[model samples]
Target chain A: MKKLINGADTVLEESLDGFAAAHADILLLGAERKFVRRRTLKPGKVGLLSGGGSGHEPLHAGFVGRGMLDAACPGQVFTSPTPDQIIEAAEAVDTGAGVLFIVKNYEGDVMNFTMAAEMTGREVASVVTNDDVAVERSTYTTGRRGVAGTLIVEKMVGAAAEIGMPLAALKALGDEINRRTRSMGVALLPCTVPAAGRPNFTLADDEMEMGVGIHGEPGRRRVRLASADAIAEELVGAILKDLAPEPGSEVLLLVNGFGATPLIELYLMVNSAKRILEGAGITAARFLTGSYVTSLDMAGVSITVSVLDGQAKELWDAPVHTAALRWGT
Target chain B: MKKLINGADTVLEESLDGFAAAHADILLLGAERKFVRRRTLKPGKVGLLSGGGSGHEPLHAGFVGRGMLDAACPGQVFTSPTPDQIIEAAEAVDTGAGVLFIVKNYEGDVMNFTMAAEMTGREVASVVTNDDVAVERSTYTTGRRGVAGTLIVEKMVGAAAEIGMPLAALKALGDEINRRTRSMGVALLPCTVPAAGRPNFTLADDEMEMGVGIHGEPGRRRVRLASADAIAEELVGAILKDLAPEPGSEVLLLVNGFGATPLIELYLMVNSAKRILEGAGITAARFLTGSYVTSLDMAGVSITVSVLDGQAKELWDAPVHTAALRWGT
Candidate 1:
């Protein structure tokens, strides 16, 4: 495999070291090596934490900062973090308000974060984001795998937390956001795991994997690759169908790159998604397009559509100062 | 050959459609399909105009928004925009304060922008960024190719312009940032130009090209692939040698990804670059990491180091809202 890593084992440590140093003002190494917490604790505020496997970057870790996540515990690539790591992170950021865990709908992630919440001995609430409408059951997930919508949840909830919202409110907010969001993706190429030294799966030069998961989980099926507009139509069609927003409903559209896709392609997909949304009479009130969440080196794109409620737009537009998502502040 | 384009011929138009739609609040399509301009032109302000080939995204176009370029003209992939297109963009945004053109050192880019400046009839000053220390001469370039350092120039000068710096002053600032900056890059694989429908160059499975250009221009040389740390040491060592700052110099480091490199790899390189700089006794006062400027889908990373003066730091830290870069707004 043509990968740029010192060693497979050292990739996580070295990456986190670089991450911590780059955002020294916002993020710090926690008491343990597996997690990172906000550099300063805002007294009397609820702490927010979200994490899972490591490969999907700019997710839990990159989202840690003011107006976003408080702490993140990244496991090895595609593996869940231990409960101890989450427990330590929970304890590190917990203030008088309480702690909220935004866990994905994956089996291992739910189990570990649940265990950590029990061990923290602090008032805690948890919300599971199962916004991926790609598949009902996947290799690592029970119902659906949480994907790009996690970013939406983290941003809105983090903003609510920043305003001193209590833990239960934040938890309910996360749940409602997830309930109104849907995402689907397609991969033109498989990503190689550094340790595996081979691609997770092989695709013919003209083939693509539809509804691919973040960690290379099996998608709906493979098909001949099509044009950007066609692909965008398929992905957005699936997401919009699952979402079924009322006509004229305002929604926040996010077109996320599955690592390795160029900005041009992502922009093209965004255009197609917007066109499709407009035809269906759903207004794209606001939109985000980039590699916000990614599977390592996979060339693909994911479309996420979330119906914006009374406060969803406000929270999303609120100031967020994080390594990945930043605005206003 | 796996790409998400409708047709190679329509790539530019479709991508721009998406780009303009996604940032409708800030960006708009010019009368001609060849350029994108700010939605609200700031009358009496010194306008900034930049344009070149279309492939290097978030470079010229993405930088168009408040506090950045007033207009960006996009040509076909890997092709220089026409003088007419540049002239239109220049005229549209030109105010009594005049307009400044930021052009890369590529022969076509320089020649065309110079012609546009002459045709605009408005007072126009131009700065050619030649921060690539890769080679003295290469394909499509005579002296040195402008690489990621163009970003530093645009950002610093854009900030200065926002505060009412005149065209000449902005030109001088762009020149200064270019002079104080140096960059180098390496590519593990070749990128395919959409129009070409094939890889730009060939590399053995275990080989890498050092000093690769953003447009698939031949780099310094190729060698057997090495560990990420070793590669980072080589790239950082070369940039520092070219930039030969004082032992105690405070510098701003930018680690940019060529289209397809993963964040994990980029962060690993960032860590390695930091370590090497520390070993040299230079302090990295601040840093930015992401695929800010990119070649289409080249799997590589570019390292840029700029000596941060008081003014440079202030401008870099200045609040600017663009589709690509934003902070402290």
Candidate 2:
């Protein structure tokens, strides 16, 4: 594999080490180096923690800062962080206000975070985000998999936590956000697993895998590659079909790139998505476009739409300062 | 080529349209759609403008907002924007305080920006960043190519401009920044131009290109690929060799990924880079790591080190809000 790594076994540890060093002013490495906590924490404020596999960067760790996650536990590539790592992170960040766990709905992640919350012995509340409308079941997930909408949950709940919201209320707000958001993805190329030393799956040059999971898992279908406009339509169509948002409802549109997809293409996809939304009479109240979540070296795009209520919109618009996503500071 | 674009001819315009739409809060589409301007330009403030090809997303355009470029002109992929587009952007953003043009060192960019400044009929000054310390001469460039170091130039100069610095002073500051910064890049995979409909160049499965230009141009050498630590040593070695900062000097390190390189790899590379810097006894005052500058879908990494003074460091930390780079605001 033409990967920029020292060794497959050392990728996660080295990456986490680099991340902590790069953002020294904003992030601190936890006891085992498997978790990262924000450098500064407000006393007695609710702590927000989130994490998953290693490849989808700028997710849990990148989002660790003032108005986002307080700490994050990154597992090995495409693997869940162990309960011990999560529990350690929870204990480190927990203040008098308690801690909240934001989790993606992968079977391993769900189980691990749940175990960590129980083992921490802190007043911990949890929310499992399962907004991917791609498939009922996938390789690593049971129901729908959590996808890009996790970003929305992190942002909204992070803002609430920043304002000292209680753990129970934060959990409810996160659940509501997860319920209102939906996502769908399409992969133009397969990603190679560093350890496996080959692509996760074989795809013909002219074909694409639609609704692919972040782990390079099988999707709902594979079809001949089409124009970006068509791909946007298919992904957005799938998400909207599952969402059925009211005609004039305001929604936040997130056009995320699976790793290896260029920003130019993401913008083009956004253009196509905006065209479709305009035609459907839905207003995109805001848009976030970039590689917020990604599979390792996968060339694809995921479309996420969060049907927004006034409170959610306010929370989304609130100031956030993180290593990956920052604004309104 | 597996590119997510509608058509080669429409890539620039469509991407610009999407960028403007997605960042409508902070960006406004120029009259010709070849440029983007900040929606909230301070009257009488010094206007900052930069532009180049469309493939480098979030470069010129994504940096348009408060405390950064007042406007950006985008040309076709890997092609410099015409004098007409540059002139239009300068004229649109020019305030009574005058306008400053930041151009890369490419021949096309220099000639075109110079022509635009002459034709704009506004008080204009320019800075051509040529910080790549790779090959002295290469395709599309003369002395050197402006790589990721251009970001440091833009950030420092943008902050100066925000404080209402005059055109001459801003140009001098930019020139100093260019002189103090150095960059070098390596490519593991080549990028495909949408127009060409194929990879710009091919690499053997076991080979890599060092000092590759953003446009997939020939570099200093091609050799067997090595570990991330060795690669980082070579790149950081090249840059530090050109820019021999004293051991106690503070510097800002930027580990930029060419398009398609995952954040995971970039972070790993950053880890390697920090190790090298530490070995050299050089203090990395701060860091900016991401795909700040890209080469379409090319998978590679570039290391940029800016020898920092107190003033430059302060400018780097100033509040500036833009689509691609935002902080402190």
Candidate 3:
């Protein structure tokens, strides 16, 4: 297998060092036993803390900025951040406003973040995002694991907090966003974690896996790679059938490229998405095309749609400042 | 030239179609235009409109939520959105509050957004973000172009607007964010645009490109592929020299991965970055790691740092809600 960098073991540390040096504006609390918030907590604002494994960038840390997360605890690659680190971050970022923990609906992330929240003596509100429509509950696991939908929950809750909305309201908004948002993803090729140094899973040149997770985890099923049109049909069909948003309802269309998918493909998919939405009598009031959230270098795409209403729409239009996302004004 | 999609021509259209169908909540303006606010614009809030090429996903669009932007115009892959499309998006999201255009400092993006902003009339505020520290002004073109620094400006301006800050303040904040921020990027391997069906550039296994642009444009220089440590040193050195934040000052650290780089690599780089910061006696008050802004599947990373003061820090701490970033409360 071909790869860049020196050795897998040193990859994480070296990269983190580089990241810190380059971005001196953000404090880096190294990956140690206790990870502290790089920034001091404001006197009144509630400190919001969220984190998980390292692979999903811009998700945990990238979201850390104004109107968003106060502190993001990053674990090792694909592994949950230890409870100690999360707890420390929670404590560090907590202001009197009370910290709201936004945890993605992943087994490890849920468990770790939950532990951190539980350990915190401060007033803590937590929301678990389970918006991936592709996964179904079978009594064994949670209904649907949070995928790209987590972005919506995080943003809504973050905005609410930034504007000094009550924690309960923020939690409710987060849950509501999750309820309205659904995501389904497909993987064209398995991504090779630098540590693993090989494809996460083997697939024929023409094979693609649907409902894949970010950690190079297996998806629901694998199928022959089909035309972008066909793939769009399947993906959109599943999302539409699952969410069943009312026709004419406004929606946020996110055509997210997994790691390696090219923009050309994403645009093509967006084109197909336009036709399908028109045919279904649905109007896409907002369209987001790009890698808002990604899975390493997975070479695939995921579709996330959030049904918006008056309140949600307002919140969606709120301005935010962060390393990864910003707008408004 | 290994790829998973069926055909190159159909990629963008199909992806968009699937995206629209999945996101019933968002209104897809069809293939001819970009996305707009799903709900009718609030009667008095100035519309915040921004757009560019399609590759930077969730950028101009994902940020179109509350506390951020009003609309985002998406163009073809790596190509700036046409003025017509931007005009339509502006019209669609405008609520008589006027519109603010947050544009990255690229030739195409600047020209296109500039044209669109001019056509929109006097109420429009256009802020161009040119935060890249890598490129130096020569006899040829404008100094450095914008990079990940655009994200920071967007968020800051978005937050100002969300809080009812006047357009003047928003514009000032955008400009300030642009001034305080700087970025530099490197590319290890060339990325492929689906329609092109080939690599945008070529790099030997032992070679890496420095100072790369977002659209797979060639960098300022090329050198032997170095270790993550070495690469980080070079990148950090340039950025630090450019910004020259105080040694003991607090700052924000952003470690951005281009498309193909894995989380493991990002983490590794982050760790390395932390060490570099320590050596400089600088602390990152905020650190973000992820593939927030990407360039297709290009295997590379960029670092951005914003020197923060009390107000900047407070604003950075404000809560926000959007597709890509969430925090606060």
Candidate 4:
């Protein structure tokens, strides 16, 4: 593999060590590497926790800090975190209000987080994110798989929780944000899991996977390569068709990159997606564009749109000081 | 070849459109697509300006904002901005305090920015960065090539300018930081220019380039691929040899990815680099790790070490509000 890993077996733990060291001011590495928690907990505020498989760096772990996640439990590459990691993270961050779990809707992830919530005595709730409309069910998930939209849910709900939102309210807000958000991805190249030492799948140079999963699962279609405008059209078309937001509604547009795609392309996708949204009479009031959610070394992009109310917009604009997303502070 | 751009001929203009739209809150797209300027210029502060080839997204343009660059001129893919574009951008952002240009040390870029500085009527100065130690003279430059260290120069000088440092002092500060900083890059895969439609260079799956440039320019040597720790030892060894920093010098460590590398690998590289620095009796006082300065889609990374004195560290810690780097704001 043309990767920079020292050992495939220790990728997660070593990377977590580096991440914690780099962002020591904002992140506290949990004992035994179960999770990375915020350095300082906000007294009386609801604790926000999230996690999932690794490989998508800067997701749950990088989002842990002020105005975002209080703790994040990371699992092995493309594998869900254990129930123990989730339970310990929830217990560590829970101060007084409660702990709210922001979990992606995968079978393993849902099972583990659900088990943790049941086992923990601390008041706990979870918003299982299933915003991918590309598939009703996938190899790894029974329902629509949560993809890039999970980051949006975490940012929005994390902001709400920062201001002492109750656990119930934070959970409700997360669900509402997840409901309004949708994402679809396309891949030009496949990524390798470190241990596998090979690309998960293969595509010809002139072909593209239309609705690929983050972990390289088969998508809705594997078609001939299309221009960026056409790809944006299909992805945004499906999203708008499913969302069907009211005419003249304002929304936040997110053009996220899968691994290996550059910022220029991500921003270009944003332009294409924005034009489509404008054509549909929706105003893209705010924008977040980058490779925050990624498939490890996969060459592609995902476009996410979240219909925003005044409140959601305010929360997104709030100060956040995480390793991945930080602004306004 | 697989990049998500509308057309190779218009990649710069279209990507600029998307970048401006995504960051409308902080960026002002320049007329005739000459540059991207800050939405709100800070009066009386030295106008910090930078420009370079377009393929390295988020280097100059993404750094244009409150505490960083006042304006950034982006050329077409891997090409330097014309003198007219640079002249126009300098005039646009130059206030009464004058403008300071932070330029990377590529021949075309240096010549164009110098010509623009001579042509522009406004008071202007420049600090050409040449922090790369891989080759004393490479395919692109007469001296060492400026790699990821350019970002550090821009950041530190930009912070100094934000606090109303005069143009002369800012230029000197930039030069000093450039003197103290050293960087070296290695590429695991070659990148394709959109117009070229193929990889710029060839590398077997088992081989790697030791010191590749940001624009696919030839580096010092190629060898069989090795582990991340061995790579880190070689790179850090060369840097410390060139720098010969004091035994206890507190330095800022930047592990920057060349486009296709993921954050996990970058952080893992950082961990390796940090261990080496500690063994050399140096303290990595601060850290900035990301795919900040990238070759379009090259899978690799560059390590930058800038020895930080009190003033430099303070300036580095100062608030910066840009699309790529934001903190303490």
Query: Per-model i-RMS in Å?
Result: 0.7, 0.8, 5.4, 0.8
Q: Quick one: ranking by DockQ, best first?
A: 1, 2, 4, 3
Clashing residue pairs in candidate 1 are none
Lowest lDDT 10-mer window, candidate 3 chain A?
A33-42
How high is the lDDT of residue A328 in model 2?
Answer: 83
Q: Estimate, for each residue in A1-329, the C-alpha lDDT of model 2 and write its tens digit.
A: 99999999999889988999989988899886968999999888898999998889878799999888999999988889999999888888987889889999999999999888888888999999999898999998889999999999999999988888888899899999999999999898988889999998978999999899998888899999899899888888888888999999889999999889999988988899999988888888899999989998999999999998889888998998888888887
What does the lDDT read for residue B251 in candidate 1?
Answer: 93
What ranges in model 1 sit over 4 Å off?
Answer: none
lDDT of 2: 0.90
lDDT of 4 by residue, A1-329 (tens): 89998889988887888898999999889999999999999899998999999999878799999988999999999999999999999989989898999999899999999999999988998899988888899999999999999988998898888887898888888999999999999999999999999899999988999999999888899999888899999999989999889999999888988889998888888888889899999999999888888888999998888999999999999999999998877
lDDT of 1 by residue, B79-145 (tens): 9999999999988898788889999999999999999888878899999999999899999999999
Per-residue alpha-carbon lDDT of candidate 3 for residues A169-288, written as tens digits (9 for 90 to 100): 777778788888888888887777767777778879768887777665666788887776677788778888888989888787778777667554676677766667668877777776
Off by over 4 Å in 2: none
Among incorrect, acceptable, medium and high, the docking class of model 4 is: high
Q: Write the per-residue lDDT of candidate 4 for residues B67-107, one digit (tens) a residue.
A: 78999999989889999999999888987888898889999
For model 1, residues A75-193, the per-residue Cα lDDT tens digits are 99989999999988888888778889999899999999999888888898999999998899999988999999999999999999999888888989999999999999999989998
